[model samples]
Target: MMDFPLKPVDHRVLLPVMMILNGVSLATAINLVVSLDPEDKITSKRGSALTLLGFIYFMSLSEILNMTALYTGLGHRYRNKFRLNSGDVLDITNKFVSAVQAAFSCVTGAIVCLWSCTRDFMRTSHYMSEAYAWFGAAYFFYDIWSMYIVHLKMYSKRRPFKNGSTLLSSGDGASVKKPDTSFLAYCKHEPVILMHHLFIGGFGFLVIVYLRGDLGDCTFGFVYLMELSTPFVSARGILSRLKLKSSRLYLINGLLMLATFFVCRVISLPYVCYLYSKVIGSSYIDAVKSLPTGCKISISILLLPQLYWFYLMCSGALKMLLPSSAALSAGDAKRRS
Candidate 1:
């Protein structure tokens, strides 16, 4: 099963889930590109070096942005609501950052992807791709760090510390010293999401930026748009926290989330494949058959998780959208049994 960190999410952490995911992704992307052979046309060793610097700079900046949002007003307001536990402060911060990122990504994607035409989707990487791609990468570098903080804080809240003692939980309910609150623990709680970020952060960079021989950067731009649904996802979680589930605004957000998730993520792979087939002058079926096995595998690796999330979303939506059935057969039967 896919575990997503959302409602009843992290309490006190530095950045949001997606921001952490974004930071880690940005750093990984830069490092991956830097390690590649310098024969590539898209980036040079020096350029990669410069981008690394930018990555670090941006990672710090992302935290500042997150902290600014949290410590000032929003965090305090959200934290006080819980009264007993403040761990949710971090979780709220995490969501705020994710929403911000989604907004930035949507704009960035549109500015770059729609600047020209779809013909260049697989054959151009000159302007915006070259200029802003690295900036996008920096976001990942910051987000990975953010994800860890929230996860750790949330873990601490879940298990709690014994005054001055170092007792903690290893995320599996077992007690340990200070807990495993390391990257490994974060990975355990958010494995699928972390992997999704990692794949996009590391390998996706190669395909979108480097492997195209400096072409189709616009396609890379489209990847940003894939995050279009992220804000809604974060918003949904926030509204849930606010206990606004039945509000009309919540309902609207949920519907938009479903639409965007379906359009941007669920069918994104097939749409890409369709575009690829069109580019190659072949039917979609033939194109799929002709694609390298590795490509097919990569697509599957990205697609399946999305489908799983969509399934979970639909199920959750049904529960949320429909009126409660107090006398559910399962509830009655379980009581009787």
Candidate 2:
């Protein structure tokens, strides 16, 4: 068992999971590469295979490193100098892991999107698109599993933190601890986080499964755009963990978050949907309708949370920018006096 949020996780479980995902990802890549048509020159096939294989290898290795950092608490040093409670430490670590994932997503997702966009869909290379989608599927599968594990711990029946001691010592020779409470109490402030994770993860898996071949390049471009706001989300987390809520950095990040959320998630997704609709609505497609309505509906439904979240993010930012309730109340008291 892992220690109270701060202790090392059970490597037995962790290592095996990483190994399995890596093995499966690599195997899939190899299979796809090997299945290339015989008509192509052997030399060209070899070059293409090696390129795809290299990407798969890099993606796997990057995942391994990311997971390792999270499980091992590799960057706890940055949390030093601040007196964080156990709850704060846990929250910060959670966000830190998210930041790492977001960073990866922004990088690789951008690459995938750029690569896809450079190719004309009518002339899109099927093998290249499959390679990207397959690799993305593997990564998101692992990500969702990891998120579910964390969600279970957070939402479990019992309190998830260490008992007997309110303080957990960090590597920086400082001890910080906070009182633990039940999940219901914990989620009172931000109840949507878990649901957001579940929905996003669910749809991501769906895209991997059913739409990988049909809509790989298009969906991927749309998907990667959603990650544009994630880095800002992660930054907000880091600032919150360090108790920098009143700082300018937090304020700036919040504004950036709103802009990116609107541009990337709120706007970009619907644009992709519009393009999808345009394709399906065209005169040529009227002769034979192959695109399913349900898939379109599902993709549209994914935008619902984005709208809600953007609202919340904007509201929060405005609230922060405005006078505090306490401040307003204090002024009222002074005027009355």
Candidate 3:
């Protein structure tokens, strides 16, 4: 397990920061619900608003779990158990798992966003839209915060390794082993990997744009594309840096996330078309009615990917920062000769 640099003050500050952010999300959700027009009673807009509320609540809950795991040192246990050795198998398995997790997070976010947007489209209410926008913003902020913590933990772990004896041999009879890779190394090419996710998202957005006559459909498509692609892009960048060969367990996880993304996109097409019809001034309001089913299926498919990706990200970060105590044993010292 990796050692963390968290002081008492750090915990105190982080707790309040998380709380304030989550509280704002909750308040925004409530405001959206409360501000709904009385005349729009029991419409799709109400459903969408409610869905947004549920998602925000869940996101807050997830963040709390993450914080607890990080602060209480449970995160250390998880990392210790799962951290990959340098010679681990390179397989497609982890990639698949990551892909699945990415897909799941996207699906989950999409459903919540879609539900809110659908409700608004049905009645032209801005409450759902506002709530949806706020939810996305809140999520982005939380993700950034979490990523920072993960980075800090990684660096703290790396310090010991950096100060330890060399692992490799050089021509001068000195050790030449490079320090284990850092999490940043694993994620350095993230921007490049994110391009694929962006492309997919752009495709979704363009499809929605074509259906502009049905504002509801357009909204759903836009949110779905945004929600689904953002995490995948982010994860892709992270995965790219890890250099988990196609055969590694983590690679398989990533592939699963990717597969989920593909599946979710396929499932969403019909709904997209329906929304498009509505957008083009077609009286086919019922086109969007079938969207809930697809959305639900997508949500279910996305669950595994989300859990796995989170696990990998946490574990990988720790591995990059902290070398196992065993790596510095007398035997290892002798091996350097």
Report lDDT per candidate: 0.65, 0.57, 0.45
After superposition, the stretches of candidate 1 with alpha carbons farther than 4 Å from their true spots are 1-62, 65-78, 81-85, 120-122, 158-179
Worst 10 residues of 1 by lDDT: 1-10
Off by over 4 Å in 2: 4-80, 122-192, 277-291, 324-326, 329-337
Best prediction by TM-score: 1
Candidate 2, residue 151: the lDDT equals 49
Tens digits of per-residue lDDT for model 2 on 1-337?
Answer: 1223323555446656766766775676567656665212223344445445544554455445444544444444444557644344445445554565455556555655565555553223334333444344344444444444444454343333455434445679786664344445545544566455555555654454344454446456567557778878978977987889999899989989989889988988656655555655664344124456766566667778888888888788777887688589899999999
Work out the TM-score per prediction. 0.73, 0.60, 0.41
Q: Candidate 3 on 218-303: residue-level lDDT in tens?
A: 34533345335335444555455445433365555555545554444434555555655665556445544444674535434433
Predicted structure 2, TM vs. truth: 0.60
Q: Candidate 3, after superposition: displacement of residue 148 in Å? A: 6.1
C-alpha-based local distance difference test score of model 2? 0.57
- Total backbone collisions for each predicted model: 23, 2, 55
Mind sharing the TM-score for model 3? Answer: 0.41
